[model samples]
Target: MKVKTGTLNRVRIIGGDWRSRTLNFPNQAGLRPTPDRVRETLFNWLGQTLYGKTCLDLFAGSGALGFEALSRGAKQLVMVEQNRPVLDALKKNSEMLKAQNVEMNHADGVQFISRETRQYDVIFLDPPFRQEYLPKLLPLLPERLTPEGVVYVESEGAIDPGEGWEVWRCSRAGQVHFHLLKRTHA
Candidate 1:
């Protein structure tokens, strides 16, 4: 059951079970899927397979990171998107892919994360760059991540991982500055 909201653009999954498969997302402001090269590098840094890992995509704009994680062997995935139309398209794509062990939430990412009790092995954080989302959201992530968990961030400029965290790996793709961050031991 495809969501018939409007004309949609497609982004191809870079690797894993759904590699080469495409998912549809609506044309909206500040909704950019992580580029293929960026994803490839990210997965390389995170390792090829994500078996048994539970993942969260807080700003699941196009379900790109969420779906990619699922395809790469994540055990469970939770995607939270505030936009109804975008969430609808994500549902349509998830159905099309027949993805399993996935949960969808139609709410603000920060709000969802604020009340979320479960810890995750990985969390994808790619919010709109125009707003100061990273600063607000970063402080909330440490508590949500398991001891070994990591956060993948995509932003317009370099991010300060705050006092107790560190950027484990980072790379640039055009204007996008992506990083993998983990909590540092004291």
Candidate 2:
């Protein structure tokens, strides 16, 4: 939780190459890193090792999901965060981990996804709660996902991903509702 060195907060890598490794970030509003328990469950649903998978982390606050994917063998990862300070913190964490496959973007996550043409094996979506970001963004995700690709969504409440998306797996931890989804049609 709180790593009392200055104003930094820390979170540990749940599993993978960096298991037990701690990452630090500033106290920024709306920046909740995925909890260790939730991440462990999500990764278990997706598999322990990503191995050569390309990934994307939208609204990548604190770089938790993306960095975890990297630790598990994700070959390439692109993380988009709107907040410059938060993005800088992500870069700092990336450097601390000596990660080479990460590409950080200081841009609006929604706009980046809407304009993105590349497809990925996995995508992490944990936008700020109560913003109704899912409705505007989910429609844009199917196209960005490679065939068989899965999307991991974390939200304040259960979400209806509409038609064509199948709920592969889902679970809840207190106020956090997470789901692993895949395209059901096409």
Candidate 3:
């Protein structure tokens, strides 16, 4: 769980059978998973209704967020990661958990989202902070997300949902911000 000097340590998986399990993270140039406290808060907001919901974890770094959803009770989980090493680690973790419902995709998160036709109930987007990916990512969400799906986006507190997205809730812990947005049904 030793992170590089001045960097953060391994984030705990938060809940379920994998609770307290710490996954290793490589010293890649730009990689920061959501902190455990923020994740716990997010899941608490989600409550006990995640069962049977399909989930998509974009920018699935350590696959921690997606795994937590699966552990809780997600019906199917799709992890999209572009980094080879991260994808490898995600695969190993999926195997370790015997996650047959977890599907791993090695590609750009945006590209996958654009090509994805199947919709998901929950989508986790934890891209690098300050990258300003939400604006671009938000518009594409309508296509991949279910009509009433919930989106959990963790950023450095810069996301401003103008008018198209109906933000259900927003909260911040430390420097991290969590958003719960829902797409209007058409």
Candidate 4:
């Protein structure tokens, strides 16, 4: 419940016993966990039929997205985070929630994508701003996503999806924008 290092930013676990309960995260190290309003909007976009779906959370800072997916009834979740301290914090959070279906991986996001052979129903990507990892990340997703699956990318502004995807939705919330893409055929 207490995330060390900075001020505690309270978050609620969506659609679970702890739903609406306040959970805290350390705000240091530029760790701005996604805003709750955005998270609620994202899940609403996903709908209530998310139960039993497989989810991949890349750039899993604070593990909020993946945890929310699971809390909303996602059957399985794989969170890939490269930073060591963040990964440790994520593991602790997962344990605190007693989420047995979650798998935590510490590795560069790109490497994790390349090595993962399984497909997921939903993939959440929130790479660091201006990193332009989208171009490099998009090509590798076809093999990792189920047919008709969606990839959600959150960035500073609009993402053009220049390669390997057909944009399904592009919307903005304040300073952040999100692109939801479906894989293109080979």
Q: Can you rank all candidates by lDDT, best first?
A: 1, 2, 3, 4
Off by over 4 Å in 1: 1-5
What TM-score goes with each of the models? 0.96, 0.95, 0.89, 0.88
Q: Order the candidate numbers by TM-score, best to worst.
A: 1, 2, 3, 4
Clashes of each: 0, 0, 0, 0
Winning candidate number (TM-score):
1
CA lDDT, every model vs. true structure: 0.92, 0.91, 0.82, 0.80
Q: Where's the lowest-lDDT run of ten residues in candidate 3?
A: 1-10
Q: After superposition on all CA atoms, what RMSD does each candidate show versus the true structure? A: 3.4, 2.6, 3.1, 3.3
Per-residue accuracy of model 2 over 66-155 as CA lDDT, tens digit each: 999999999999999998878888999999999998999989988999789999999999999999999999889999999889999999
lDDT of 4 by residue, 1-106 (tens): 4546635555666665447644455564546677777787777778854788999998988777888888888999999988776777788788788887889898
- 10 residues in a row with least lDDT, candidate 2: 1-10
Kindly report which residue stretches of model 3 are placed more than 4 angstroms away from their true locations once superposed: 1-9
Query: Candidate 2: misplaced stretches above 4 Å?
Result: 1-6
Cα lDDT tens digits, model 3, 94-176, are 87778768899999988889889999999999987777787778888877777778899888874676657777888888888
TM-score for candidate 2, please give it. Answer: 0.95
